[model samples]
Target: MTEDMKMDTVVALLRDQPDPINVLYAVSLMGLTKGLWKVSGAGSAGVTRAFGEDIWRLIKIGSTLLKADQDTSNPQKAMEFYDSYLIGRFNVADSMDYDVTDDSIEITVKNCRAHHYTDYLEENDVPRSVGCPLALGCAAMMEEVTGDPFIVDSIESKDGNSKIVLKKF
Candidate 1:
């Protein structure tokens, strides 16, 4: 297929699914691609893992691009980024709640897809700390965009829900 046809296929798939499903679909595709590359000896396992993680970092940065377009220091911008950008892209926007303080933002993902995805991995003996990179990438992107230190204050994914607290470093 031509590049345009491939893009059209991707667009169609995304449009047909809900955002959370899209996120999961994207994860599935990434896994399949990585697994195939490993089987084909396209790259070493470490290299492939790094490549996949770098791509995810870029995606996380891209998701926070809207925040860069706005005044990052604004509390409302922070809230919008949390609600619309971070949670929104995960297809959990409706299920997340956040509070914006003067120097911190706390968010609770009542039903995080990543948490469930991690559970699925653990059940199958896939040793991966799935949520940290995504969270840290977002924090890194936010810090870069806002010129303010941002750190993951706490992340609890073992429980039924994923709760993340981002605070100024």
Candidate 2:
């Protein structure tokens, strides 16, 4: 299965069920835990593509539901839903880690090879989470767990590892 297809399946399932625990478990089973190996084995989008798509979908759906509740003057219900279904089901690290299924995110390599790449997004002066998109999201998740602000802002221009530095509002 292609990674995008896999992601679409998961998203559809979640949208249908709306059960957070089951959603989390189902995500794990969808080869999210399998990481790069899974991508190379069965998915065509690679690890980054699959993981990024899944997380983005999850966030989009969750935000959509919350917004609907908010515009209806029932933010409490939405907040409660998030608290029970989302927050209670996964930790900050797990939430973000659960998002990205990259072997490199958790893998430890023995041999080292160095290649230099330019960092166009010079995240200086302004504080931004460090490392891969998932890792950075993980840090923001940690903040949320600790009752801190959701730190990492999702760059609309730069969602994943798309070597670009477009302005993100």
Candidate 3:
């Protein structure tokens, strides 16, 4: 089978599985992204960016399967829901705190997997930010939940923690 066909089959299978299984697979997929970053050399940033876009696309697909039930009209509630969703769905961080306002969302994540993954990339001479897929994931989910577009304004990481800021667009 071709690569596209193989990926389609895998995605179909994943979509059919339980949430816990899908979360495990999603975490494993991060290792694949790391390996891709290592080999892409100067194109590592593009590869990482593509991975982030793919994450958004994948979440869009998953959201269709599991529609959100909460009333996420409030900006604060939407941001809080996205925070819990990230932790529950992808195990991206050990814990997350959010500061949400009318036009912005600031999140501080502790023990973030994306930070550690980017640290590995940095060690390999690839200078990539710590929030590629994580930032995109948040933006995509927030947009889906709140019906408002968001852009990643900033991402900073230190000592296994990351602070990401997303602005409404």
| Model 3 Cα lDDT, one tens digit per residue, 21-139 | 65475546555655765676546555555555677666545555678444467777756666666677778779988887767778888987555445444444444353356776766
Q: Across residues 1-169, which tens digit of lDDT does each residue of candidate 2 receive?
A: 4556445544555555456886665445333334433335423323433443455346437767666332212323322333243333333211211221111112111111100000111121111122233323333333333333332332221222221111111
TM-score per model over all chains: 0.47, 0.25, 0.56
Q: lDDT at 67 for candidate 2?
A: 61
Residue 149's lDDT in candidate 2: 30
**Model 1 weakest lDDT span, ten residues long:** 122-131
Where model 2 places Cα greater than 4 Å from the true spot, the runs are 1-45, 68-133, 136-169
Ranked by lDDT, top first: 3, 1, 2
Q: After superposition, how far is residue 111 of candidate 1 from its true place, in Å?
A: 1.3
Kindly state the number of residue pairs that clash in model 1.
0
**lDDT, each prediction:** 0.52, 0.31, 0.63
Which stretches in model 3 have alpha-carbon errors above 4 Å? 1-50, 53-70, 123-131, 143-149
Pick the winner on TM-score between candidates 1 and 2.
1
Candidate whose TM-score is highest: 3
